[model samples]
Target: MSDSLCESVDSTNETPSKKTQLEDGSDSLSVIKKAVVVLTRLPEYKISALRPPTPQQFYSEDESHSSSDSDMEWEPEGDSGDSDFSVPDNKQKTGKPTQNDTTKTLPPQTSTNNDSVSEPAPIIISSAFAYCANEITKVRPNLPEEEVKVDMMVLARKRHMRWQRGKIVEIITREDGRLKYKVNFVEKGKSLVSGHHIAFDTTPKLEQLYVGARVVVNCQDETFRPAILAELPSRKNRLRFLVFLDDHIPVYVGLPFLHLVCRPLENVLDDVPDSPHKSFMSRYLRDWPNPHLTQYKAGYILNAELNGVQQRCEVQEVDSSLIHVVFKDNQHKEWIHRGSIRLEHMARFWELRRVQDVSD
Candidate 1:
């Protein structure tokens, strides 16, 4: 019994010591965890304190400098309370500009005036009649009557049994409800004519005034004289033409002063009746073939068919299979098959013109 009591006491003492040691170890581990947390937090605090300034802060500094350096002594144009800060009047007396002042005083922003900038002029296309396999229909003499208005220029059949240029001066309604126009022929006097005797004045195509064609030219003396077109107008010659008058007098006339009389199919040289003027004109009449016949190249103008209708097109690019072209009439771009292009031929051109003249 004595031995059992001694052993029990010793066990109780040892258990208390072990409990104390475990409690101390737990406290030391908690302290070490707290120290680790503090060490990590210290670096974050230092980094935040050393951070660079924000953009707003830099802008505020620039604003302060601008306020001090501006020469104008006026306050900002707004409610004083709305502004974050105000410039003192004393700062304005410096009369010196800061670096920011140069930027502020820079020339006012300029905008392009689209109206003042002129648009590029449209491409002026020379007109031509395309050769058609089908026959051209004639302009019917007894066609449907058209409505006429005052001050409209028209073709009126007057004294000479030929169509003459006239202007519609007045309108007359007959008892039968038929309308007659008081046509004022510039050369002839005014007379009343029915709608059947009047037609709209149409401008002839430039192709009809080709070189070697017959036309009546208004001479310098303002007299309309018979002449043969010696040379077509070109950019080099200021768009004027060289013509031989009936008396074999050569003259340069503007396009507006010439009227097409006829386009003969035969060579112009054949009709010249062997004279010095005829020999002089032969130099201009040497049948020049279409330039593109040798090779298709960029910027060359040629007759091309688009959607089965012939139109003048400027060549943009040429390849083995397709040719890129832009239509002169509407500026429409298209890729045309090589076969669709009709290169102009001198003999064929005159033949087509003859057919058109007969149809008209």
Candidate 2:
């Protein structure tokens, strides 16, 4: 049998026809038995535990050391690299970083001394106006017959429902004893209006007046014109005083028509109770918009006089003297005089809207 197995092995190596010879069932069985006998005859083999390769096998000594060091020092992005791997007590409980931890981790370090850091100081504001103009309800007083006269500058309500500045051109007596005046508007031509539809261009004077006092004069266009009292009324001109308007225009205003702007004493304001109204009044008066400094530009929203009334309008175009605007109420486009546009009113309107939104 050994001799036969040797012959069969020699035949398998010497001839490729051995595969055809092994095609028979008995021959294939003998071939398997010969393979098992060959494996058994080899030196007894023992299997040992497998071991992973060392870095030195693939890399040089310097490279292996560097790779090992990098692995030891590597960390995920945003990691502070602190030795303590344990999460903070607050973070463990909340599962989110505390405000202090966030501040420290997010912002780049700018200073070495963290102990010197301090919070910003709070801002303090002082009150200015003694009275709240917004709280007051204005009533139009009935003008005496003598006060309404020809050539007098006044504000008259037109058919379009806006009060426009105009000068009385004629006074007409009606058969019913009532009176009406023909007014020549500064820009809107002329119109006939009754006494009740007219407002006098007059401001009540303060008890004590001095030169250089800040005052607001009622202009012909039914708007307040900020001015400085330049010259006091003299014996020669007791009725009128020379004042410099915000536009640098100097004019003589009647004594009864100079409105003084009263500013509360800082000490007095401190004595008053602290309230939102007082605070708002203080801030609003301090930052009041100056019409003289108003710069008109396209897309600007402002209160403009249109067809004898003030309307919220968006500026569409601007030029040297006229501003083209589309009224917000009716979307009517009109070209208005630049002097009749009030940017301060727009600011006040936005401020009120913001306050209302917050309240809601």
Candidate maximizing lDDT: 1
Determine which window of 10 residues in candidate 2 has minimal summed lDDT.
121-130
What is the C-alpha lDDT profile of model 2 across 1-360, one tens digit per residue? 342222122223321223434454555422332322232222222111123356454654323321211101212234333221111211212222222111011111132234333211111111111122221112222333235678888766564224567899999989998677899998788888666556566554333454444455665665655555544543212335655554434456676666543331222224223543234334433332211112244554555555556656676765322356798789998654332323334334446557879999
Distance from true location, Cα of 282 in model 2, Å: 28
**TM-score for predicted model 2 compared with the true structure:** 0.22
Q: Candidate 2: lDDT of 293?
A: 18
Quote the positional error of residue 235 for candidate 2 in Å.
36
Lowest lDDT block of 10, candidate 1: 121-130
Question: What overall lDDT goes with each candidate model?
Answer: 0.45, 0.43
- Encode model 1's per-residue lDDT on 1-360: one tens digit a residue: 231122112121221121223664563222211111111223455555556775434643433332211222334333443222222221223333333232111112232333233211111111111112111111122333244689988666564224467799998889999778888987878778766455555434554455566555655665555556654554222355656664555566666777654222245456445754465456334521111111233554555555556666676765422346798779988654232223222223435546879999
Q: Each candidate's TM vs. the true structure?
A: 0.25, 0.22
